[model samples]
Target: MAQPPSPHVERPGPAEVRDPLVLTELKRAGVWAGVVLAVLGVIYLAEPLLLIIGGLIFAVLLDGGARLIGRALPIPRGVRLVLVIFLCLGFFGWLFWYAGTTFAGQFEALRQTVEAQGAKLLGWAHTHGLVDEDRPQMVTQQLVGSVGRLTSALGSAIGVITSAVLILALGIFFASEPRLYHRGVAWMLPLRKRDFFYRLLERVGFNLRRLLFGRLLGMITEGLFTWAMLAAGGVPFAALLALITGSLAFIPNIGALISGALMVAVGFSAGTGTGVWAIIVYFAVHNIEGYVVMPYIARKTVDLAPAAVLAAQLIFGALFGFLGLLLADPILASLKVALEEWAGVDPHAEEGEEVASPE
Candidate 1:
């Protein structure tokens, strides 16, 4: 005789929980508690994480630049990579060998120049009724004190040379076998969604590479142009100003503004005519870079808003100090890419579309 069919047992759907309300509430509480613990853990790991972030950025630069050169040359990628690394190291070595002593002296001179300029400006302000004469000393003391405290805080957070070394080492290792790291990260995702995550990673990586390329190109061009113009006009501390302008150019929007102000101040200190020339050179160079070059490149890459970038810098800078400030733009870009991918939001989607074209 055929056995009776086993009794059917209906399984509850995910949205249908048969557990008591108290048990559900306890589960929810446990989840929230776990989240809090995770946040605290992150805070504890902030130092190492910051260094890792630094390494990641450096690796991206190396990999991106090397890839570009490899595409142009007949040489193997590994050989090209070695060449790129050595060239970078050699450039830094030569730079220090050439300017180490002079740079130190120039740095001191820059400090003195800024101090003297501050005094001169204050006096001028008093003379022109821009500041109250009787309260000048008080205002100066307050501003100087605030700046000193802030600098001290920032310097401490940066730790020292050891942190720098750690970041450098990590970066080189990451660059050497980036695909391993890529695969490791892919492994962490759900198996079914691994392919999607891999694609997201590629898109995000390319976006980061493009952003960095644009920034690097801008830095080099601006620095060189500024140096050429200043040296031609015989401006004092031309080398130092060029260095400042170039390094600062790494930051978006406000970076140019700060560099420009510093140049103008130093320029005016030299002479009225020199100041006017510096302003003209700055406006011309940046206008070309910002309007023509940046737009063209951004159209091909990512077009981040100035306000959004500036805000990220300010927030991150306050939270993690220097590393935070440095990595803010890349962090923002990566987040944007991840969100767009996960949310299925088409960046180029038309306003009235029911289903966006994947293209």
Candidate 2:
């Protein structure tokens, strides 16, 4: 009675095509395989992974700089980024060209002064009975052995150069298409998780940007103040010392110690008066930075405890050496952010914003 029966359509069997359960199983397997591969990759190619992280950090720095420039001038972010990069390159280039000749001489003098100081200190140690005169030969042997190890270790300095190049290239690429990469990272998470992760990334980016800004400001302030003070006080190699101090300031606690010691030693190389002035300048500038500038900035951003940072530096330094020490604070900060979110804690909660209290 009805119209002619609808034409029969052949459906493919599970074997001929695919089954839903089988597809789901396959997807799970593929995901597990990917996870395993990634773990293995990190273990085997740690240097490259570190370089990638370095590149990301560098990109963050570039992005942060561009944002500051953007606030001052109305321009496209891309153009601003390019200008910031060029400005940075120009600055470094000028620094190198400006001080190349002096740096060579100063560095040589620094080496000789360090050796002289070392001998003087050792003699003092012997006179003060800090060293067992009975084992004088042992002390010399240990010194020579340590020097040998250091020189041998420097043989791998080429690896550092390669890593720098890798970081630069990767940073430029990442900075160029940040949004694309950011979205791609979000896409890797489940739909429900993506939103939370997106917000997490936003906070991280903001914190890192702020952290780097504070760091840059502190470095410049310390370096310039140091240079002016030292130069005015007639400290030899003032510019070079300031440059080293600025570069090392990025490394936090250990860096300050090293820079301060180096500057003091260099200062003493000239005279007692110069040495005293250098020490005074170091204390004044760094105290203000450590107490005033850094505290104000950290309250606004990183908020990491100094002791905790030093501990992290120790752990990361043992695990990954110099680069780890450099990145320890940021890594710890990111970890803190993740933990707070996981624990359902509000980082910026006010007094009235407490969820629970003694009623």
Candidate 3:
């Protein structure tokens, strides 16, 4: 009963999109696709990116030292930076000259000790019914294989040396004129966003410097305490253990576990008594650093949540390997600063500082 069949009209499908509303929807989908592709790209290029991050972290360390030197020296920035570099070089030179052969011997011993201890542990676990008896050897083999893979993931000895040199070079360049790089980065941003980016960068730099300073303090305290305590107790590998502990202390929870494991293993190489003492020393050193040194430092720096850092480390380490684990905390700290800035929080606000109340 319709008047004549309505004129046949072909309407555009979503795929043929002509309406502005449809165009907007298409743009949103395109953005999501681009984001996915970008993530894939990042995963593929993670190694070089991680190296860059490592360089930036090193730059932060150098810059922090330079600043500290500046406080008392009243010297030019470049001069202070140069002096810091020389001091570092001199320390390392002295260390090698003094203990090069000793360290070389201890390192071989340490490797053998760790492997023996690890095998013993697996055996103990199997005997205790913790690991399946049939698969005990398999588990140990897999553990060994995983370690091999981790080492290879970082590359061969030459490659590792090359990467370290590159990082150091990049750090020097970046620390030399950070502001230039800052401006260069900001120049790439949209005009409206540049201000925010600049502010975020400033906050990131400030937080990183403070974090590294606190970390340095912790490392020194832990190393000295461990060395002194272990020496007094006549623990085997006292010097070597202290060195490892101090270096690993730069890392957080995981580092402590690793160093403690190594220490205990080496300690047991001497005897059960020494091993017990090693365990005691581990707890005592960590407890003092955690409860005493770090808390005071945290009040003056960017205090990261332990869980947050651990989570980041696991994720990054899984995705990108060792370098990722090393840089995760710094990356997280940077992200934290950016988030706070995004949320309109004041970057310079002290913890527990009061906000003004309206009358």
Give lDDT tens digits, candidate 1, residues 144-261: 7754543332365346556767777887899888889989988887787877777787778888888888888888998999999988977788988898888888877767887887
Candidate lDDT values, in order: 0.79, 0.80, 0.83
Once fitted onto the true fold, the runs of candidate 3 whose alpha carbons sit more than 4 angstroms away are 1-18, 92-99, 132-135, 347-359
Clashing pairs in 1: none
List the candidate 1 regions with Cα displacement exceeding 4 Å.
1-18, 132-160, 346-359
Among these predictions, the greatest lDDT belongs to 3
Q: By summed lDDT, which 10 consecutive residues of candidate 2 come out lowest?
A: 350-359
- State which candidate, 2 or 3, has the greater lDDT: 3
**lDDT at 206, model 1:** 87
TM-score-superior candidate, 1 or 3: 3
TM-score of 3: 0.87
Of the candidates numbered 1 and 2, which has the greater TM-score value?
A: 1
Q: Say which candidate scores most in TM-score.
A: 3
Which segments of model 2 are wrong by more than 4 Å?
A: 1-43, 134-157, 352-359
Residue 276 displacement in candidate 3 (angstroms): 1.2
Question: Compared with the true structure, what per-residue lDDT tens digits does model 3 show for residues 287-323?
Answer: 9988998788767766778899899988888788778
Steric clash pairs (candidate 3): none
- Superpose all Cα atoms of candidate 2 onto the true structure and report the RMSD in Å to 1 decimal: 7.3
Which sequence of candidate numbers ranks them by TM-score, best first? 3, 1, 2
Model 2 clash tally?
0
